[model samples]
Target: MSKMTGAQAVLECLKREGVDVVFGLPGGVLLPLYDAIYQSDIRHILVRHEQGAAHMADGYARATGKVGVCIATSGPGATNLVTGIANAYMDSVPMVAITGQVNTWLIGKDAFQEADITGITLPITKHNYLLRSATDITRVFREAFYIASTGRPGPVLIDLPRDVTVDEVEFSWPEVELSGYHPSVKPHEMQIKKAARALMDSSRPVIYVGGGVRYAGAHRELFELATKINAPVTTTLMGIGCFPEDHPLSLGMLGMHGTKYANYAIQESDLIVAIGARFDDRVTGKISSFAPRAKIVHIDVDPAEVGKNVRVDIPVVGDAKNALHGLLKEVSPKARSEWNEKTETWKKDYPLRYIPDMNVIKPQFVIEKLCEIAPDAIITTEVGQNQMWAAQFFVHKDPSKFISSGGLGTMGYGFPAAIGAKMGRPECDVIDVAGDGSFLMNSQELATAVVNDIPVKVAVLNNGCLGMVRQWQELFFEKRYSATILGRTSPDFVKLAEAYGAVGLRATKPSEVEPVIRAALATDRPVVMDFIVSPAEKVSPMVPAGATLSEILELEWCDVAQSCHLEKIYAEGRKEVLGQEEF
Candidate 1:
């Protein structure tokens, strides 16, 4: 066997693991790896910020169902990736983050660029490795990739010392033999049978799906089982497109801002077949009251998540597709005419509705117009109001169509994620649905788009404030509006786009919305549209925290007309009816 440098070992390991592209920024400590990368076949994408690199890797992993890879150097470079790593950890995206560390001798000595990245990222990663020797390079990489892409997929870190990357060792890529780290891919047979039995017996069963189905590539299996059993489906925010929103059985998204009918169905169902989804607090609301009457059959790839939050009558731990297939075979279909009728009643009563007033421009209207113009376009969104609005208004017909920071809810995710998604699927039109606040956080990436000649359209909802938080403060905190307003004299986003060498448009009136969006789409260069929407608008049908899913408060048309002054209307109307005698 020939002697190879640590950098060569890393490249060999990545090749063996089938890593095609790496998202990263190079630095002094990682010069050896960069040198080897120059000679290797793997492609490297240099990002503007290290955080952007990590998020790009995350987007790639979520879109392709592969373990995304990212690299950064010691100290500050590594520290910059912390937010993205945490984002991946929260969402359980499969990724491998490799960082260069100071030489082994200087690790604990507070050397110029030294930081304990492994220690810093321990809570946010599935596992982490600190490589002290050249021999450990190959094994650490193999282990990191395996852990990242396997069961309960998450980010894993491998920190390499600068000296180690240049050191020479005998090169022989050994097959990984992890005796102590076997993941449970096969669900227990008894648990599978129990789940099957539950499905067979229930009359009012609804399948709740989430991102795990997408991760496992089990969309077909999920569709097959749901169709076979005639069970209506509801999805968490992460599971939006796993089942097509237009499907007859699909009840759209369910959560804080979920459809009223979807939340009601969960309340009334007798059996909830939750597949590849966690009962996140956002979805469940109050654990004690959520789906109070329903028996749950929770199936997931991770055993630890089986009963982490909600109690499960049946728990199946395996690949979601495989386990679902096993259950389908065991269960016999049952008739449930009454249950279907009840759900249909709820659907008709509380159908998703938004008034399109010609006088004032609405955010939902812009989203709908964009959807009409670019039906198959890929969409990335920042967190908060824009994210929820996209989920509510956008119609996604394809899998991997909508990319956003779901679990992490990272604010500045849209622009860079759009860049990465565009890079991954270049033929498709990619757009970032961003709020003004979130857009400013990563607006710097417009330079990256302009430099690469990537024609990503950014639709900025310039509401002049943090709209979502302002809504909360308006409703719950007595309209104090603390630190929520962007105030007057906002940055000239159009001029900013022009300065970055990208096309810009401003849309204020409702009539200008579609024309501006179409203009952006017509461009072959990066474009940003400053869509000035109504600042007073709020995402309605909000379910308060620690409340039951059924206890949703819908903001009525009258409420909107009164500018959220519901108490005054209530007092006046009731007093008039009662002749003020009771008072």
Candidate 2:
């Protein structure tokens, strides 16, 4: 076996594991690692902040279906990554976060920059390790990647003490062994059969697709199953893009800010075929009344999530693709014509809407135009109004196209994520749909993009307030408007972009929305398009906190309550794209 330093082994292992790029920041204890990085062929993206590194790694993983890697120093650097790590954990993104630790002898002395990162991230990570020796480096790295990419993919951490990185050790690719960590790839035949029966027996069935479908690369399988069963499909927020929104059967998205039709469908269905979904509160409001009449058939890769949130009548705990493939083989095509008509009526009657004021640009309209013009751009979103508006208005036609902070809902996720996604797929255009409040959280990353020559685009829905908080304050808190306003302190986004050596553009009126977006996209450099939008806008069809789907309140729905707001032209366009007239 060749003898090399632990830092060298880390790089060698990464090369053998097929990792070409890593996002990270260098610190004191990581000096040795950085020196090794300089001598190595692997590409390292220098992020402005450690948090951006973690988020960028997450975005890369989501875009490429490969394990993303991020590295950071001890103490503050490691702690900064907590939010992004938790975000990836909540959404189950595959990632490996490496952190430098204090010297082994000084670990317990609380030396400067020392931190117990493994203990701090215990609850959030799938698994974590604190290196004891240089020899353990290869085995630990292999294990970290294996654990992160397997069974319900999630972030894993490896805390390497400074001494371990510098110490020399014998190098050999040891066999990865975790006797208790077996992930079931093939599900039980009996469970699949049971699920098939439940799906076929019920006349009113809804297919609830989740993020697991995307993780499993099961979009085709999901498509086949949805069509074969003839069920109306609704995706959780994390599940977006797993099923095509333009498809007649799609109910857009379901949950707090979900389509009213989808909530109604869930309320009335006799059977729900939940594929690779965990029934989180965001997706299932008021669990007692959620799918009250429907028997749930949950399919997931992680056994723990099968019935954790909602009761399952049939549980198939295995890989989503395998379970879906098994389901496809057992179930044959069936028609529920009455059910189809009912679902269509719900879709037509309660289509997503906004009272378009021509004087100011509406965020939803901006998203609609974005989808129209940049049909092929990969989208990442910050949490809050921009995220919901993007979810509501954009028609996603491909899997792995829509990336956002689903579980943790980190505010600054989109911009760095966009940079990472662009790096992962350089040929495709990557855009960050951000709100003013969330954009400022990691706005400094503009320097990272420009300096690295990563030409990612950002569309800021600048409402001049914390949009979601303002909406809640208006509806629930009597519009007190205490700390929700950001207009007084918000930066001039155009100036901010220009300061970072990036192209900056703004759209204040409805007419300039398309032009600004087009111009930003036309630029080969990093571009930020700030759309000054109305603060009064709210993401409609909102299910109030702790309320059942039946209790959903649509803001504009009250205004257009008398008649359906859906246009004939929209359906015609959808048909033209889908290339079929009949549903």
Candidate 3:
């Protein structure tokens, strides 16, 4: 054991945990910690805001499957990290956020720049700490990383008071032992068998996937199980990159703005083999009507999630990879020819499409071009229509290729996230698909990018308004468009990019989309490519709020005709099966 200041011990602990980089900002209270950071070999990316640091760490974690770290000062600095912490918490991203507090003597005295960061982040973090002594520094850092990266991974905070940082103590890493925090990693044999039997007996089975599968590194097992059982696979928004969308059984994303085929397939399936998926309201649409005909076999690491959203016929609570391994033993290969045929018909009937208009560029067309240009790039998205469009148009074949804020749906997440992703995977292409309103939120990060020489690409879908909210206003609220539009006074994104010493390109027509995207991709410096898309264009096949999946509304008549035709085919098939076979 060696004697050292708490700040030095913190850096040492981080080094032990394989943390090479941190995203953060410094303040008065963090002086000692920043001094320690400066002396250490660990790379620190100075962010414009504490919130950006949190998001950058979150993005780093999501991209690399490693625990991300961020630091901030007390009071407003700590508070600024709240939204990013909440975003990571809601999406189950593994992160550790450290904040410096005022001196211990000043505690509870309402000192300047003093606020209870631990209390403020209580609801958003998996676990948090308030360091009362230098002696506990090693233990706290160890536990923080452990808790942050463990089962149901999420953001964990550690508050370091100024006195604690300056105090000297002999340190030794403690053996982590916590009584009520064990996560189940093994499934019951009987439960696995029972789930297998259910899947075997069902004529129409669909596998519903979520982010947990990716987090647990269970995609291999998940893929094997689905392929062996000949079941169609539909993923939640968070699960987009977990399954190969190009696969024959891939139904792409389901629910809300999910593919028409996926929604229909889930509604018609007899069995839902849900893997690491929570039945979020967006995915389920109307809960009462969602998968009304199906029995669900829910496999998750968290026992609390088994029946929290929907009733499960078989609840196997364990690590998703292990649970999938258990199921693989009991499940046998079977040709689901009829079910496959139905899904194929659905796929053929309603494909994601848009009418070609050369005058005004459609956002979907831009995304399609991006897919063609950099199919293997790490794609992050800002919330709203850009997110939905990215989910729909981008074909993600590998896990971790797509990252976004799902549960919280935070805007301005993608750019910083892309930066973090680029930092984590320098060789891989990192692109942030963003909206104009969302991009402007954290666009100041352009300075961070240029300063650090992190060449992340940004695709701004500029519609001159908050397109998603405007769509809602147009459809449901009688076009009472509230403070959504940015108007003509909005800053020119290309000029703004130039101001940041970054390349900026704009595409106004349909033909210009591909070339502009290509130009952005070719740049070695950070590039912001703004595509001025139509303000009137809306996401199609939308299931209106409070509506069931079957009641999805299509933007065009051709889509309506196709959906109707698929329903007719299904009705006829059901009648034939009822009259003749036991299927």
Candidate 4:
């Protein structure tokens, strides 16, 4: 058999795995791998920071439903990838992270740029390896990709020691084997029947979808099941695109800053058909009180998540697509005319609202306009008010369209993510709906986009503060603003974009909102459009921390309480739940 260096084998394995592009930064021990990359046909994106590389890879994977690859060196370079690795793990995005380690001989001697990346990322990765020899290189890479892209997809790390990378080994592809890593692709017949029975018996049922629906390519099955059951569907923040937002069955997003109708529906549900969703605390609110009366039918690929959060009456541990496909056959079409009418009334009564200001632009208005202009665009968001507004206003027509940092809630995720999305799908329009605070966290990526000629657009809702934190301070802390205000140190975004050799535009008035967004979209180069918005604007339909979904507060709800001088919002929520007038 022909022989090749471990670095060359890595390239060969990547090519075999269909990896055409990778996002990463170069460092000392990574030079050999970088050299291999340079000599190969594979394209490598040079990110400004190692964190951006990880997020970019994540974004690409989310957009394409494929395994994304990212590389970093040892020490700080490997450490910087930790947050992004965790972000992928939480969101169930498929990614393989490669880190160059110091020589195996110097591993414990604290050599220069040495780090135990495998150990560092143990909790955040589905699996990780510390290569001891060049002979293990091919097997390690094959296993990493296999583990990363299967089951409940997540990041996998392969730590390559410098000596192992340069050493010569046989060039044959190794067969991947893992005895304890079998993921069930089929749902249990008995459990699926039980879930179907639960759905048919309940008049007030709701389908709760999460990121797994998108990861498993189960959107079609989810839609079929929801329609067959005639159940109201409420998606988690990560599940935004799993169901079409404009569908009659859709309750939009639920929990925290979720829509009023969605939170109310969950509070009143008798049966919750949770498909591929881990009942996260953010979605559950107070765990004990959430969906208090509902009998849960949990379906997930990961067995550990079945009864880990809320208890489930029927648990089907299998791939979401397969489970949902089987469920569609076992369940008969259900009709809950009364339940539908009630949810419709709630949706009409408590619609998402923002006051129109002729003097200044509203963040929601900008998001709506972008949705109108780019209806088919792939949208990404940083964590905060901007994320909520985009989730509320921007209608995602299909899965793999709405990408955001949901589980990890990373602020700097959107910009670099948009770049990766653009690279993954050059035909589709990609946009990052960002907050001023979050945009600045990785604004350096604008250079990466411009340099690569990736034409992704960014809309920065410049409220001159960390809008979400300031909103909380406004509501809970008696408006005692602390470090949340960013106006004093906020950079001029238009100037910043221009310095990065990107197109820059600003919108100060409501009239300029549409024009600015259109102009940004028309540009063939990377563009950053800064929309100066009101500081007082808050994402409404909010459920207070540690409170039940019944305690959702909206603009009108907040106004009424403020006028009545009420000390607690729970009192108002109690009245509403009792069918009393809200105001």
Best by lDDT: 2
Worst 10 residues of 2 by lDDT: 559-568
Give the alpha carbon lDDT tens digit for every residue of 1-583 in model 4: 7898889999999999999899999899988888899999999999999999999999999999889999999999999999999999999889999999998999999899987788888899999999999888888888989999999999999998888889999987868889989988788999989998888899899999998888889898888888877889999988888998898889999999899999999999999989888988888899999999899999999999999989889999999899888888888887757999999899899888887767767788998899899999999999999999999999887778899998889999999999988889999999999999999999999989999999999999987778899788878898776777666225888999999999999988999998998888887999999998766678887899899998888754223333122223324444555675544
Model 1 scores worst on lDDT over the 10 consecutive residues at 562-571
Worst 10 residues of 3 by lDDT: 557-566
* TM-scores, all models, native as reference: 0.93, 0.95, 0.95, 0.95
Residue 167, model 2, lDDT: 98
CA error at residue 412 for candidate 3, angstroms: 0.8
lDDT of each: 0.85, 0.90, 0.89, 0.88
Greater-lDDT candidate between 3 and 4: 3
Candidate 1 at 486: error in angstroms? Answer: 0.8
User: Which portions of model 1 show Cα errors greater than 4 Å?
Assistant: 334-336, 557-583
For candidate 1, write residues 31-62 as lDDT tens digits. 99999999999988887888888888887777
List pairs with backbone clashes in candidate 2: none
